[model samples]
Each structure stands twice: as C-alpha cells, then as structure tokens.
Target: MTDQLPPQPTTPPPPAEPPAEPLVAPTAELAKRQLTPLAAGVLGLAIGAAVVGGAWLVTATTGPSEPATFTLKGTFALTDSVYTDPGDDSCRGSADSGYDDIAEGTSVTVYGAEGDVIATGSLGQSNSDETGTACTYKIAVPDVPSGEKFYKVEVSHRGTVQLTAEEAENGELAASLG
Candidate 1:
C-alpha cells in the first residue's frame, strides 16, 4: 500500500501569447479607405433622414396642451352728485356694475346701505346692444333723497373680483364731493 502511493502529476503550461502591436497603422489605413463623393452624400442624406423621421414619429405620438381657457370677472362702484337744476340741491346715490343686463323696459332696483330701495330705474334697450370688456348704462335714479346723506358702493364678480366696499369712511368718499 505504501508503494501504491501515486506520483504528483503536473500539467504542461499554456502557450505564450504574441506581443500586441499599436493600432495606429490599422486605424490610419482604415481612414485612407474613403467613399466616393456621391456615396458620402447619399450616406449623409440617409443619416439625416433617419434622424428627422425619428423626431417626427416622436412628435406625432405626443400632443401639446389645449389652449388655455381663461376668463375674468369683476365689478366696480361709483358715486356721483346730481342736481335737479343749476341752483337745486345735490343728492347722494351710487352706481354699480353687477346686474343682470336689464333689457329695455326691464325694471331695476338698487338698495342703499340700509337695504332701502334708494333708486328705482328702468333699463333702456337703446344702449343694450354694446358688449365687451366694458359696458355702460344710462341709469336714471328717478328720485333723489331730500336731505344730506351718505352713499355706499358695492361690487362683486366671480372668485376673481368678489364684493368690495368703495367708501373710505375716513373722508375718502367726501373727497370727491366737490
């Protein structure tokens, strides 16, 4: 059994590799192999077309946002003094922009700070034909209060321009009395 012990085996080594040569010669030779002008032009056109076609496909599959739909809502108030005649006393009232466009022959009423119908006017179709960002109405507040009084203006619209008071009690309203 001792004599049967196997001798250690050794495998032959792999073959040695050849030394590497610089790639400069092969690269230069490849560069020297040039295509004809016509072939080069055709190849350039094909590359350009491929790029353009790819871009077109990408664009065609995608869509742009819909044109924005927006609107503006607002209201304003104004107070003006009016005298029956040059020598008559002036009365106080207000004009506001927030009524259903009253049609000709339509009856309209405006309330004062106390909710009293301060003005009772009729809508005239004569000026109803106009429309745009601004509108004007020939309002006739047929009767004016008989004594010295205060006036208030109120305006309202959508969320854009909600109701607001126009008077500056600290004498802002009187500043325009003259």
Candidate 2:
C-alpha cells in the first residue's frame, strides 16, 4: 500500500503594531511645561517649611500639659443644722423634730513638692436633718503640681483620716469621718 503524508497544518501571521512615539514630548514643550530649577528649589523649600511648620503647630497644641488638680471626698460632722430665718429672726422650722442638722464648714491644707504649703481650701456646706451619718462634702483643691502624688490632706473637723490609694493614684483623695 502506498503511504500518504499527513496534511500540513495552517498557521496565522502575527498582528501588525502601531508606530512607536517618544515617551516624552518635545524638549521645548517639556521645558515650557516643567518648573525651572529656581522655581523647583523655592517650591521644595516652601513645601518643606510647610511640613515642618505644620508639625510644630500640631505638637504645640498637644504638648506641655497643664498641671493636675485633686478632689477630696469625705464626710464632715454637722455641729449645727439650724437654718437662720432670712425673713424673720425666729427658730421654729426644724426638719428633725425641733432640731436641724447640717455639715459644718471644713478646711484643708495641702503641701507642695517642696514641702511648703501650696494650697488651702474650705469645703462647702451640706444640709442635714439631724439623722443618719455625717454629711458628705466634696473638697476641691485646684492647681496641684504635676509631679506630686500625695498632698498630705489635713481636714479641720475630722483630724487625720486615710484615703484610698486608688483614689490618690487617680488624682483624687477620698475619706470618711464619723
């Protein structure tokens, strides 16, 4: 038998490509479009200055924190709770039967970092009905130094009392005096 060769396979030609152009425009056009050396230097300086100045401004606002203050929570005894009659000089309207009870005035002395007395304040008054426990007062001491943790609190009415260390750690001093 006569052997016949296999038929030849057909192949397609490659596609044509578009003409290539220069990556950049003409030098004259590029020169017109681009910044000069002096211009570039000034622009770079301005940008750098703007970045630095912006950083400085941001840090200035958030830096150098103000000093810390403290609030003391404690109870004060009410030696007298009788409200003086504003309209007429008389003592009859007493909430507790015939006696009124309110917290008396209190003062505190706070020492500074140098062991000198830095701040002193008188606590506000609290009304009482001559019953229950003593009245509670929130003693505020402002403008304490940043480095000072404890202020050596001395209450006028309660003598000496120990406040919670946690409260002192969080810039607050709290105590209860009967």
Best by lDDT: 2
Q: Residue-wise lDDT of candidate 2 within 52-88, one digit each (tens)?
A: 9999999999998767654544434333334544453
Scored by Cα lDDT, where does model 1 land? 0.38
Cα-based TM-score, every candidate? 0.24, 0.39
Report the lDDT tens digits of candidate 1 across residue range 46-156: 999999999999888886844422111121222232211124222222224333322234444434445565544453222211122222233343443322134432222
The global C-alpha lDDT for each of the candidates, from Candidate 1 onward, is: 0.38, 0.55
Query: Which candidate's TM-score is highest?
Result: 2
| Global fold similarity of model 2 (TM-score) | 0.39
Candidate 2 at residue 3, lDDT? 96
